[model samples]
Target: MTPPISRSHPGLRAVFELAEFLDHGQKLPEQSRSLLAQALQECIADGFDTSLFTALGITQWGGVPAVKKIGLLRRDRVLRRLRSRIPEWASLSPNAAAKEMSASFRRYETTRWPRERHSAKGPAAQPNSIWWGLLRSELGVPGEKRLAQILKAEIQDGFEFPKGPATVAGTGEHPENTGTNIR
Candidate 1:
């Protein structure tokens, strides 16, 4: 028999975090929110069925949920921007888009939360070079392309690509892909 599912998937966690932020009357920082909105749009363009309202546990009336109408509006704005900014994005396959998005998330996470390293003397303090580097890299790809590039890199460096369509399922063991290197 299949094991019981765990809702610990990265995508699910992102959705939950967004939902919790909204629920707590806190606004998502613009950059993070835009990243998420673009990711959703990429999934949609790639023919992946995505319902932000449902993912965030908000009930939809007609088509849009009223509770998070503002966020939905922002998402719609971001979607339009993505379509206009990335001419070839609409033609990308679901698998390809998912792969790109995974890469983007991985990069964003690393930059946003750099790991603290400890030394024999003490914890090594360093400026956020990762975040700065990502910022500089974004200059090469204007608008949404930067996000796409980041997402596409998500599965590199021995990271395993999703075996099927995107879902909030656990990423099973990928012995071949396990490593400390970030690609």
Candidate 2:
């Protein structure tokens, strides 16, 4: 068998190391999840199987991958896009939501690497706190609000979404469900 084609540059040490992290099933500092997510996303785009980390990234990066950035830099515009997509987000079926959520990054990724495409869909956004926190960051929401609380609010406001399977509850058995807490 032949090796996979990738747009990753040799100088991108952080990205490669991150790839190793996923390959080895190692975790990093809690605060660095997004950066890890960004790296895993890059690898997935490059034809690597990387379902180890949460597959979310800042849409503000346009299409280029950032090696070390933490939070969303352009809060106003990113938050605007997130708000504008609420109805679109809420209306998706479970499978479609996964595809769409993963494509949130893919939508930009394709612009940079035109030929890059993958069948890897991410977990849904509504039940994921990373998505909720980033989405509601501009709403003056209390920082203490967890994903359950945010999801409850979303449901109360008619934005009900599907939950992750209960079968994967904290067992760490499936790679796709690695970053999720289904219980």
Candidate 3:
């Protein structure tokens, strides 16, 4: 007998579906696009979908929850301005700063078009770097680093990047494109 689908199944499934769609670099077909959009939104409403981000392999920023608007800000003036304040914002209580950061990251995920949300370049990848920049800017520590500082006691962990599995393999810079950080 088949096992029941886990709550994260839809979100995880959406992650790959969207990636494949974007990888094709062709026009987003309406039918497939709508289906993917529903899956992604449902993933949020239904349950925690950490597995979805994991599949995207955007771990460079540590553990920032993957969000679309922030992901799409690649080189945008608005994002740059906000990011420039990392030093200032990071100075606040780490918990408070992180809470706000997560909110900011999530703010536009649902509203942006699925295709544009995933669009970005290698260097401009936001999920991880933004998280790291905020922490590094101020006294606060990003979740990844905080957890890492205590590695002797315990140990580690990813988000939205455009140049996913296919582009990485094509780079040919490495003998094998095995790392999770897609950019």
Candidate 4:
């Protein structure tokens, strides 16, 4: 039998370890988690968001300061973007309404990175230990394009827009359900 190709990098292993702990609701070793937290804080301070933490693939079982900083940075960027892009209704606009809406959107977008990045990265980003037999059967083909198509289909069918709000309804358990509550 041939050995399977391992696409994950060594640098990503620590990130994956952190991700696994988060996925399993387990706490990471204090030292390792702390380091990740520090890195995360620096990333946010440098203008990255919590979503970047998720993009680098760590969320649960990391440092609190990092996570909060990520959130705050994201909120700041989003509000800046919104205020710049959206025109004021001047006298009639609600106080800080745009900022509030932008903050909510930022939170939602940042929270979505975990699942979205997973899908976006394609099978190439998945760990080697994952059974290709099962994954291939479920996703069809092992190439990048196939993976992207699969994710796009899942994203389109999996989540729905909420009534009266921009929020999505439902948890992201099903392939067709891209909405997650882990924010």
Using Cα atoms with residue i matched to residue i, what is each candidate's TM-score against the true structure? 0.23, 0.19, 0.24, 0.26
lDDT of 1 by residue, 1-183 (tens): 333222343333455456446434446656547657877776587676645544433334335443343333222222323333344544675345534434553565465434422211211111122222223223211234644444343332221122421111112211122211111
> lDDT (0-100) at residue 131 of candidate 2?
35
Which runs in model 4 stand beyond 4 Å of their true positions?
1-11, 49-140, 143-183
lDDT of 3 by residue, 1-183 (tens): 334323234443354446555555545546546656554565576574533344333322323334432222221221223333566543545445445555554442333323343333222344433332322222222343342222222111022233422222122221122211212
Over 4 Å off in model 3, which ranges? 1-85, 113-115, 118-183
Report the Cα lDDT for candidate 3.
0.36
The lDDT values for all models are: 0.36, 0.34, 0.36, 0.34
Off by over 4 Å in 1: 1-67, 87-91, 113-183
Better of 1 and 4 by TM-score: 4
Better of 2 and 3 by TM-score: 3
* Candidates 1 and 2, the one with greater TM-score: 1
Q: Give the worst 10-residue stretch by lDDT in candidate 3.
A: 150-159
Q: Write the per-residue lDDT of candidate 4 for residues 38-117, one digit (tens) a residue.
A: 77777778777545445444453334433443333222332232333444522223334433433443443356433444
User: Which residue pairs collide, candidate 1?
Assistant: 100-151, 100-152, 103-154, 104-150, 104-151
Over all chains combined, what TM-score does candidate 4 have? Answer: 0.26
**Ranking of all candidate structures by their lDDT, best first:** 1, 3, 4, 2
lDDT of 4: 0.34
Model 2 lDDT per residue over 1-183, tens place: 223213232223234344335444555444355566666777779676543222332221334333212122222222233433568755655345445555653343345223322212224443232232333332222122231133223222111112221122234232134423221
